[model samples]
Target: MMIQKQYKFYAAHRNEELNDKCSNLHGHRYGVTCFFEVERTGSLTTLFADFDDSIEPHLKREYDHAMMIHVKDPLYQTLLRHMKETGETLRLKCFSCPTTVENLAHQLFTEITEMGFRLNRLEIRETDTSVVSYTREDWVNDNRYFASYQIPPSESVS
Candidate 1:
């Protein structure tokens, strides 16, 4: 059997590698839907994963109203400068990885796997019309051999 859940989060980010206006900061009401593969448990309940227990809380914490800033982004330092100059509280949650939709999919995949849910597919939608999907099989076939999210030793924070 297969069970699915859809989750949402509001976040802001920018992509510096791009040549267009995306170089400016922007926000999105991102949507993520995960498909889970499951088997009947024990005496025979069809339920495999609970949305509230397995997913929602984590999404709410990691992304809701958060800022996704790549570590190499200069804005990262700019934000720090502003904080130091103004003594203001910067409540934004900074992500260690780039904030593109593809990276978001990878981030969510890592989280879902760590939570022990058996996932079949993950769909990350940047907008109502723009979306990207990744299957578990795709991750297995990736050249990085599923270690795509690892921080290289030279880049690791001290």
Candidate 2:
């Protein structure tokens, strides 16, 4: 079964060296939709996991009204370290990493997966007509393939 949920956050960011209008700091009211594919564990009374219970809180804290900074930005790097040292809540869009839709989806996918939930797909909308999606399959197959291996049963090997 597949379950989907939508979230919104307001954030600001810029490509520091893009040399375009986008290089000037700006904000957007962004929307993100996540689709989760669930495999049945043969449990009763559930078609899929609860979106509220599984996904909402993480979205709120990590993305909502937060600055999306680039990890390589020296200023952002310094501020992030200061925040860590002082335990201060960071300003929205004040991130230590780039805040592009691709990066956002990548980061969110990792976060959700690490939280013990399988993320099937992620859709990030920067505007009503502009959208980007990242699928779990894409992540697993992103030029990092290793040789496949399998173990045969002991009896079959004998």
Candidate 3:
């Protein structure tokens, strides 16, 4: 059996690898749909509520209303400094690669799968007209960019 769930998160990011408008910081209401395969246990494969319980917290904690920036982005340090000096709360999610939609999709997929879910497909709507789709096969075949990169402690001043 297969089941699907959708999630919405608002986050700010920029593709530092680009030279266009995408390089500027911006926010979007991203829509994510995840398809999962499960074994039928009597009449149900899994409870939708169970999915929500496991996934929602991760999204809220890491992505919702957060600023996702590559650890190397200049803004990354500036934002951290600002938050620390002012003692303000900023939900900053740092990444090792450019915060493009494609990378974001892959990150989410990896996170979800690591949670013990049999994730088969992931779709991310970066905007009303733009979407990125990813699957386990794609992730496996492609070079896992920044997959093992870790942010240095000095970079996280806050």
Candidate 4:
């Protein structure tokens, strides 16, 4: 019932609210796993959404080589000034709150959901090994108990 696609992008960001070392402007190669539920009768066409044609252009254009900045952050001005002085148009995405991994995941999840995709989950990784996963079940309003399955146990787990 669930399907996923992984994507890669590079970005610069600093988390002002947390005041952690991430408070410093830096870049990272990010990995994101987008999850969707199969629609036997999909809304778009044959499938839920096209990665290359649909999601790619929208997400890649905003995130690839982009800088994430909160408007309240002092570094926001610095980055703007630098861009103005250098005459280099850097891809920048501004957030109202701190740019944390969790926040970014939620942001993407919201956008994808608005696009009419039944987003099941989202996994964000700053590195290949470091990952954070999110789902509607992760938040309070969407929480519910899953019906216990009586299927046989998997050999892999045993």
Candidate 5:
């Protein structure tokens, strides 16, 4: 069985080096849809988890009105440290990659995966008509999980 949930939050971000445009600070009413696939359980209960109880709080705290920062940016690091020292309650994101819609989708996917949920897909809508989708398929083939698989002896014998 598969269940999907959607959430929205307003966030501000900028491309650290996008010179033409999107380099300046801008805000977006971002929409996020998270897909989850659960094992078949024999029960009448709802397969989808409660948004308010399970997901809303997280979105509210982490993303709502927050400044999404690309961690690799030296400027972001400087600002983050200054904010921390000043005791500012700033919701910041330290991303290893650039702060783009595509990276945002990947980051969300990673977070959901880390939380032990079987994530099917994550969609980050940057605009009403534009969005980026990241799926578990992208990460499943990554070399990070190579150690988890054991090679059969037939191949090794050669």
Candidate 6:
């Protein structure tokens, strides 16, 4: 037995490795579809609310309206310096790797699984026409190379 859910988030990112327009900072209305495997024995294998409880808050805090950037991105340091100097806040979700749809899928998959959900697969819709999918098997194969996402510490007032 299995269940599926769809979620949406708006975020900004750039692909530094790309030479095209994608290398420029841009935002997207991302769509995520998650599939979970459940046991067939129960009257309700899982409640839909359980999914929302686990994922919605994470999406809101980390990805929604946030700038998803790699720590090595030039803009990252500039933004951090500006935030410290001017005492402004920027919602930055830093990643050890590029903020690509594939990586996003892996990150979310790992998170959901770690939260004790039997996640079977995850799909990220980067754009209207571009989508990336990851399965449990894929995650197992690539888990060794996955780098966890990072959140920069707040600057101390001096």
Candidate that scores best on lDDT: 6
- Name the 10 consecutive residues with the lowest summed lDDT in model 6: 149-158
Candidate 4 lDDT by residue in tens digits, 21-109: 87778988988888888655665434534654667776677788888776668887777788789987767787655677876776777
Q: Candidate 1's C-alpha lDDT?
A: 0.74
lDDT of 2 by residue, 1-158 (tens): 77777878887777775778977668878888878777767764244446656666766665566666665556566766787899885664433345567766766776677777767998888888999888997657531332132211111000
Local accuracy of candidate 5 as per-residue lDDT tens digits, 21-134? 798888999999887877765764244554346567767766788778676567776776777799775667555556788767766676667667777888888899998777
- Candidate 3 lands at a TM-score of 0.88
Error of 5 at 119 (Å): 1.0
Q: For candidate 1, lDDT tens digit of each residue in 1-158?
A: 77777888888888877888787899999888888887866876444346557688777766777677777788988887888899885545555656678777776786788788888999988988999998886655642743576753112111
* TM-score winner, 2 or 4: 4
Stretches of candidate 2 exceeding 4 Å from the true structure: 41-49, 74-89, 92-97, 141-158
Number of the candidate with higher TM-score, 3 or 5? 3
Lowest-lDDT window of 10 residues in candidate 1?
149-158
- On residues 1-158, what C-alpha lDDT tens digit does candidate 6 reach at each position? 88999999999999998999989999999999999998866677788999899889878877899888888779888988999999999888887678888877877887788889899989999889998889999898667554232333222111
Residue 54's lDDT within candidate 2 is: 60
Q: Each prediction's Cα lDDT score?
A: 0.74, 0.65, 0.82, 0.70, 0.70, 0.83
Which candidate do you rate higher for lDDT, 2 or 3?
3
Q: Which parts of model 3 are misplaced by more than 4 Å?
A: 142-158
- Provide the lowest-lDDT 10-residue window in model 4: 149-158
Give all candidate RMSDs, comma-separated: 3.7, 10.6, 3.0, 12.1, 9.5, 4.1
Q: Give the clashing pairs for model 1.
A: none
Clashes of each: 0, 14, 0, 0, 0, 0
Best by TM-score: 6
